[model samples]
Target chain A: MRLRLLCCGAALLLLAACSSTPDESLYSDGSGQLGGPPGPISPDGTIGSADLNGGQPAPGTQEDLELTVGDRVFFDYDSTVLSPVATETLDRQGAWLKQFGSIVITVEGHTDERGTREYNLALGDRRATAVKNYLVALNIAPERILTISYGEERPADPGNDETAWSNNRRAVTVVTTVN
Target chain B: MTLPRSPRARWLPALAWLAACLVLPRAAGAVVELDITEGVVEPVPIAITEFHGQTPAEQKFGRDLADVVTADLARSGLFRPLDRRAFIQSPAELIDLPRFADWRQINAEALVTGVITGGEGGTELAVEFRLWDVFAGNQMRGQRLSGTPDQWRRIAHKIADTIYARLTGEKGYFDSRIVYVAETGPTTDRVKRLAIMDQDGANHEFLTDGGDLVLTPRFHPDGNSLGFMVFRQPVPQVYKYDLLTGREARLGDFGGMTFAPRFSPDGRWLAMSQAENGNSDVYLLDLDSGRKRRLTDHPAIDTSAAFAPDGERLVFNSDRAGSPQLYTMRPDGGDVQRISFNGGNYGSPTWSPRGDLIAFTKITGGVFHIGVMKTDGSDERLLTESQLDEAPTFAPNGRVILFTRKDYRDNHIRLYTVDIAGGQVQELPTPLDASDPDWSPLRP
Candidate 1:
């Protein structure tokens, strides 16, 4: 009787796996490319979740480096210094960079479209400089880094609020690996 | 097909009178007039005869001066110069006789003929221009001017200005440039940089790379530098950039937000808004000393300040009265009085260059509009009503206001100009979307 129950449970599990959504059907090989059907569920049981916690992209997805507000550090109303949490994330990013070893990066700094042009240029300069400075401290060659600023011309989120503004204030680090 | 040639064309005075009478009547007009709100934008028919001078150098100066005038006017998307090959007479005789019949045959409605002579320090450039009712064969207006060779460019501008004023009844934009925040990329990650273009919207070049978010770029009184705000991580600081050298430095250390900056007409001081602890107020920074003096003490949002043309008074936007409205005060920050009361929240109040009016953005009934009023806040006229229209800057003559108009989708932005009389408004085309247009001071 116990063996019969086990066989029934296995059959139900196979049926559940076959009914997975398209997003759930995507899977990546260890080589970081699409390989096969996605596991019916993530190890954590979330079917359609971002793999940011694992420092990897979801299966079958291209690597997206576009910086959003959530990925960047926010400052107080008038500050530019990176916070502790920001530093921690940078550390993880630095480890990733060390592992890749052949990637060139450009860091862009930006602000909310609240200030004037000349001031924003200088402010953006400082923000990009801050990120570049941090990367260099992590033993990355300074020669491989390029910095630019868009002041407030670009926004990840266009809403006019603390939410949007926080997203707008960011320094993005984009990595390009030499093939 | 042969009309009798005027004696002026042949260097004979007698035949000129005969042709003038025969061809002149076409220039007369009945009392009826039509408003020219729109046209095909055909080039204005203009003829610049080679100017003569006493010496070869002076003569060369004369020709160069005419060429400059032709180039300036022709490039303005306005005037079309008649080919010199079609001229019936030499410049000297054309100035003396001005046979309207000869000009009319070639479709030349306006003519400029001049001569140059040696002056104390530079070649004396003298120019004479006539605005003609070509169809009527009558001269509308004529004037002669003399200045140094170095002033040849100015003389050309003056002529263009006069001709434009006479033909269109509107001031010319030939002597101006536009400073705008140039935008690129997707809606989510837009890259904005400071850029300047000729007043007609040509010669666009980025002053700063797209790395930071800059806003409210205003040309200094001299048109050589710009003052704007920069957000460095946590602080929005004010700074000025010398367009010629690309040298930029901090304008002031407001500790909080320093924005809405404008340079006094003399370029000696800057007026802007400073927000500390969430309360924005107006302040002025002395360009030389970098010393900031508070202009307003209210706790409400006091921003978008501008100096009157005379540099003795200022106009600014303030919500101190419960909603945004325009206010004026003496340069010393005294005698503050309300200047706008028609309705809707008003901000970005820029004083007219002529010192007679102020242009501002008004938000009322869920629409954004560009409006103008006298310095005393009277005779208000809304120039444009749009989904989003703000940042109005005046042309040097105070005849037009150039501002940004955002489309209904909030995705596209275009530059537009409106006549101060509220009669004509036109959109300026650009390869890419543009915003935050700041008009340069009249070319010196």
Candidate 2:
């Protein structure tokens, strides 16, 4: 009787995996393109239920740099200096880069909508460079890292308060390619 | 030239005596000279009558043209167009001769009269306008504009520019175009496109599809091309879009990101910021030679470089002093002097066309303000205060500034215009949410 119960549980797990596989593939292929149309879910009532952690990538794939390792590092107001927390995050990212030797990454610097657009662009550039520098110091190849500054154009949070501002001032590490 | 001393020219001798007194050194107790340095700050009251037209099509064009001129003048804040209801003379009556006495009774300091006629083949338009100084009792300006019927609006703006220049003794910015970023969607995943429109927000059209992220559309001094940045995933680069041909090309072959592009005063070179290995610096790219020269090599972030009107110097924002601040330097990036000292961060410093002041965005105590100061950092005046105001672009005449203001509640960004003297803040109407507006030099 115990063996039959175990077999039943295994079948249910397989069914769940089979049902979610198509949605996972759709997101991984379609939504991975920056600024592309979002993926569509099946009408199986799994919308917003499976893998809804802020659209994080699945594990073990090259895009999973954002999921398995960390993807973002936060900065203080009008500052590009890497904090202790930011350094810790960069350390993990550097290790991930070392393990995935063929994967290339782009560090996008962003700022909260506080200062002028052009200045924030420069600030974002500084933050992104700071992240790249930290990763390089941790033995990541400089040639594998690219940096861009979006200034205050792209915000992680759409709020105006301090919490949203803190979340918006971030440097995101994106996996660009894998050979 | 000599004119007969008729009753109409009766003020000639008095004006001559006044001119003589102004040109000659003053003697003791000479003519009781009055030193008048201050003038009226109120809007100059003017009346713009509906233009008289011969044919039906001409009439429609005339009415539309006159309405556009009226709106343009009213938006300047320096001119107060009297209501049409209060007009004492009709367009037909004013075609023969303006009733200056009637206009003066309505408190109109100036009067405008025009006549429109459909040209041969009904494809061309001929517009004639006369500007009369009502109090002075003289025709200040008279001109004719002929163009295709589709260009009726341009003809109207030309007339307004004439009147504006005559009365204010300054160049007009009405006959100009504004290139800006039109935004839509939520703040998190906003779609932005390059859009161009008349200075008064007419004839709006998108120059690009919202395929990739676009920002900071700046018009070249020639007014026929635009420079902006486009983001294509991992890289963003500056691009030049030719208005006449609708052709686009990358400004440089940089390996990394290049942004915040502005043309030189002569439209011969582009000043932009380039980022590599995480450090961004200002660079000047020669359009003719395809040569790139790094302007600033600071460890801190240095970008947003704008050439002065004379092209001998540049004003840019830098964080070398720990926070973003306005700085001015020679074109080759020497003699750097910090031009902002307020207890806040200053950024996006754009030199005025008149070369008297530099407009900038300032952030202090979590509030953003649009402010102006002399090139040497004196007479700092903040013209606007809000939760987020930035990217101030000066009008061609330097009497006004257009900037972006973000509503703190909804994070919706809109374009606003404020007078340099700082009184009323006027919101520019845009079909979509707009930001990063750059006013073109007065177009011919």
Candidate 3:
């Protein structure tokens, strides 16, 4: 009865908008690309989801690397070239990865929302590569590191100003198992 | 229930979105030549009489359809739909002929009248729309668009498009769809989902959940498939999604991040950008051969590739010459000609459907502009300027460009359409922040 009235309300609307209501069949298990708004789903981030429990990490763990040595290295606007600060942070990341060799880590390159989506993605890829290469120069095994570019999509800082852009443009090392 | 749950029964119940053949009018109205790109011209005032129907329920239903047609024309910034309340007669009372003087008194130069028959069946509706020149007292445009009752909104757009094409020589962009990335949540951890809707922002539906990130959806030439980038399990990759079958096929595991997938004019190949070890280059994937061909081997960032309308050449953005600019090349990656030199960095170049121009995102003076240029990159003109305007997608008719507009004050992004000739701006209302709008070809 409620759906029928909602359908009637849709008839009164400017266009046929009853279909805008959530239809159950369009929601799927992500196996098929059924397109519909699935509400309130937890964000599937590479780093957060890989955490086995909701608890804090023990000492000297990858989470500790993020907490202590810093797992991210920032970049300039449209520049993939790492700064001295970035290399130093990456040097710490390399040491952390060397100590913890069992679990593979993914380097997520991100960017500010200043550029186009495709361009920022490539820019992020370059930033990730710089971090990987800087650590590889430290004699870190290249095979242990995988790089993914989130572009401006997964921004560390969502603000539009320079402060946010500075924080947003960085390469994050996420300890993960590729969910 | 609920119109058969689209994707399972999108547009048509069976078969593909291909082979959509338009029924040309019997007698062509002189295509009204309005050089709208130049100076301001007053909008043509038109009266949209409520579509007459048999029953009370049907009459209200018919009125709703007229409202859609009315809004579609009004949003074009070319038509001024008159107040329906001023009509001397409800359409149901005067069935055969409309009183011309009644409309003329309201200064309605054109009169639109429609009829809806057998709409309640929820299966098929017999819809007819007639566009009459109020001064000439003759029928200028008439079309019978019979569609499912569920498709009343689209049928209304079809009628509006028919009148638009008859009144102006250009093809109509109404009766079209826009696939975009819908955003919610906070600025830092925004959930971007794939959403689809009509060009008028009605009949909306989200195509994907927020579980994964989706971006930059480009429609197939047939309008049945989509090529979009998704950050799913394994890593970020591009996938070609078939709207007809709801089948998602990952383009490839190119051993790196793949972004920006655009279909060729012939729908034969998808040109995309791949980044491996920080080096980005353009690559083409053959749809049938299941093979990949390298189009650019530059050490510089070479990405965001789209095909020209003729299918003979490809236009893309590259920073090989020290700054990002637009360039065109043959499919084999030869004949590399530098095209953009208007003193701004250029990226995201999309060729117009008319094959005469290309629209791109230009960053100059700390502001981004959606600019268009000739195929050879001459007569460059900026359409809209904002804090940030990126990813300009041409309307199927090639007369308007829809793009992303990021507001500086709020940092909230929205979708807006500008005239191809830089005439007007219309902000599309979405439920949440939206960006990366790709307009689909005219629906069947």
lDDT (Cα, tens digit) per residue for candidate 1, span B1-444 = 111121112221111011122122334572112233453355567887777666777677777767767776664555688788999978667646677788778877666666565643553455555555655656665667555444455556666676677676666656567888877887676677888876765455778887876777899987778997665654657788877667778786666567778999999999987755435678888889988889898766677789989998999877678666889999888999998888777777888887898998887876788989999999898889977787889988786788888785666888998767664568877767888889987664
Q: In model 1, how large is the Cα lDDT of residue B160? A: 69
Give the Cα lDDT of each candidate: 0.67, 0.79, 0.79
Better of 1 and 2 by lDDT: 2
What is candidate 2's CAPRI-style docking category based on DockQ? medium
- Model 2 TM-score on a 0 to 1 scale: 0.85
> Taking the tens digit of each residue's C-alpha lDDT, what string does model 3 give over A85-172?
6676676677777776665678889988878889888888888888878888988878777888888888766567787777778888
Write down the TM-score for model 3. Answer: 0.84
Per-residue accuracy of model 1 over A1-179 as CA lDDT, tens digit each: 99877755654564464445433112211111222343233465443323222223332121322211112444443346787756755665565566656667666677764443323443555577677788789998877666666655566677755666676677777664453
CA lDDT, candidate 3, residue B317: 88
DockQ of 1: 0.12
Model 1 regions more than 4 Å off: A1-179, B1-97, B104-109, B113-158, B165-173
DockQ of each: 0.12, 0.60, 0.50
The reply for model 2, stretches above 4 Å from the true place, is A1-59, A62-68, B1-40, B119-122
Model 2 chain B poorest ten-residue lDDT run: B13-22
Highest DockQ among the candidates is held by which one? 2
The CAPRI class of candidate 3 is: medium
- Judged by TM-score relative to the true structure, which candidate is superior, 2 or 3? 2
DockQ result, candidate 2 = 0.60
